[model samples]
Target: MRSRRAGRTTGPHLRPRLRRHPRPRRSRGTGTRTRTRTRPHTAVLTAVLLLLAGPAGCSGPGARPPADGSAPDAGSRSPSAATGGEDGAGHWRPKPGTPWQWQLSGRVDTSVDVPVYDIDGFENDAETVDRLHADGRKVICYINAGAWEDFRPDRDDFPRAVRGRGNGWPGERWLDIRRTAVLRPLMARRMDMCRDKGFDAVEPDLMDGYLNRTGFPLTARHQLAYNRMLAELAHERGLAVGLKNDLPQIPELVGSFDFAVNEECAEFGECAALTPFVEQDKAVFHAEYALDPDDYCAESERLRLSSLRKKLSLDAWRRPCP
Candidate 1:
């Protein structure tokens, strides 16, 4: 649940994308249905995935969660196989324990000594990314991949059929990611902005909405397909991509992504969920607002996650794990 709301994970809002216009009338009557234990799949979709991302294996045998009923989600498909050859060449792959500054709100304090920065994709422009690169730092462009925010410039581009139930956050609705035929072009354009702006990596947030009450028939397979499509888009453009907070899919996706970005994994006692990224020697860039440095830093350091503590506003001020 991306949100027990009034709690973790309602991040920064996008800057207004267009002049104030009447919101397109939205259909608000979609029914929420109980999802099945297994996601439905067709041969064509599987063939498309195998063609886009080659069959890549898990980073390690131990990285797979146990075969018991306790870890049934472990059977999900991995997006890594498609990340082979030149797909991984042009992007920045952060080290397992790199220090980072995540400030999606307020004027960025570029003087922070961290080697990486995560900032809003819409609010930040090409010059902002260039400045970070000038200081010998890698930059990650943060975008809402699963939800649509009214404030975004391209807000009107979302079709009524694609919008789903509200995500507790005001002016935001989860998009039906299963509609890749429609979403790919739009998301590709957003990634094009990232590439044109000189971003080194991308953090696509709200990807786990399929696990929530998003008034859609989205299955685990749909999420896997959409996420791999995002990865391929980023890779094709020569930009690094992170699998944001879809912890349940880590074992299947760690190889497709260069890193992972998570919120409140520490607060929820779920930091261990990111072990697959670390096992593959990839970074787990984690943040917590509810816990103090004293409460989570030791465990974060032990997990080798590059952890930080910042308010939910995601401003410039921060307390990094020692």
Candidate 2:
């Protein structure tokens, strides 16, 4: 009985031992020992991760990595971008008390050489414009916008349909500004010429044609449309455009122009008309052909106009209001 019990226990124990030690099983279809087996899915995942990591580790040309490895802001990507000023949406309004010189007759006396020049557009050449610019002076191309001057290179370009009564000046006739379709492209070309000549601004003279006997029944709306077109064309070429005279429309047109070049605003008791410009922080360059320097000095000082007295011919002989 004891022998039988020993046999039973030994047999059971040996069977368990044999099962535990049974097979050092080889991998199926290969003579390799079976160990911890990783899945094909795990290998595929590792390969995909490595491929993704390769591109992340590489740097492209002109690209800069953020200091903290965060995504870059929109502005950070473009370092050479301009911030603001004339390149942006800001208007080109020249400051008050800006020194300027005006010469409208004969060959351009580009001799005074101030920070600003009021030069005859028809008489001045591209070289003259460049030389004035090189001297650090802002050039204003003076063009007769209200009247047709016989001396202009484009004198023949004005159609008889647009030309009207004489403007009291010899060889000068008033223009029918109501026809904007014909005049806009002409004036735009003129502004283009000024811009191409390196002029920084345009001084469109005779803007007060509506006030004068222009031979056409020019309403204020017609004048406004024509004037606004001039402003837009000037702005399109990045050039500053000035409002010359046109006292009646100052309140309506002040914002459209960069500066105001008025003739005899003080004489007509219309100095108050130009206050809109001063209030809007725009420069008003006033010149009087009739008034002496001493006569208008105090009034000009009170009104804050860059007032000067000169001959009607507009020579270099400038006499500032005291």
Best-performing candidate as measured by TM-score: 1
lDDT of each residue in 1-322, candidate 2, tens digit only = 0000111221100000011122354332223221111111334334433533322111112223233533222211111122112423454566655556777654556656346778867567899988876766678887767677665678799998899986543455778999888898889889888888888889876665665566899776888888888889889988888887665566679878888887655543456556777766677887765544555556665655666655444546565543
Tens-place lDDT per residue, model 1, 187-271, is: 9999998889999888887776666667898777889889999999999988899998765676678889999987666554456
Model 2 deviation from native, Cα RMSD in Å: 40.9
The C-alpha local distance difference test score for the whole of candidate 2 amounts to 0.60
Stretches of model 1 off by over 4 angstroms after superposition? 1-88
Best by lDDT: 1
Give residue 258's error in model 1 in angstroms. Answer: 0.5
Every model: Cα RMSD to truth:
12.7, 40.9
Q: lDDT values of the candidates?
A: 0.67, 0.60
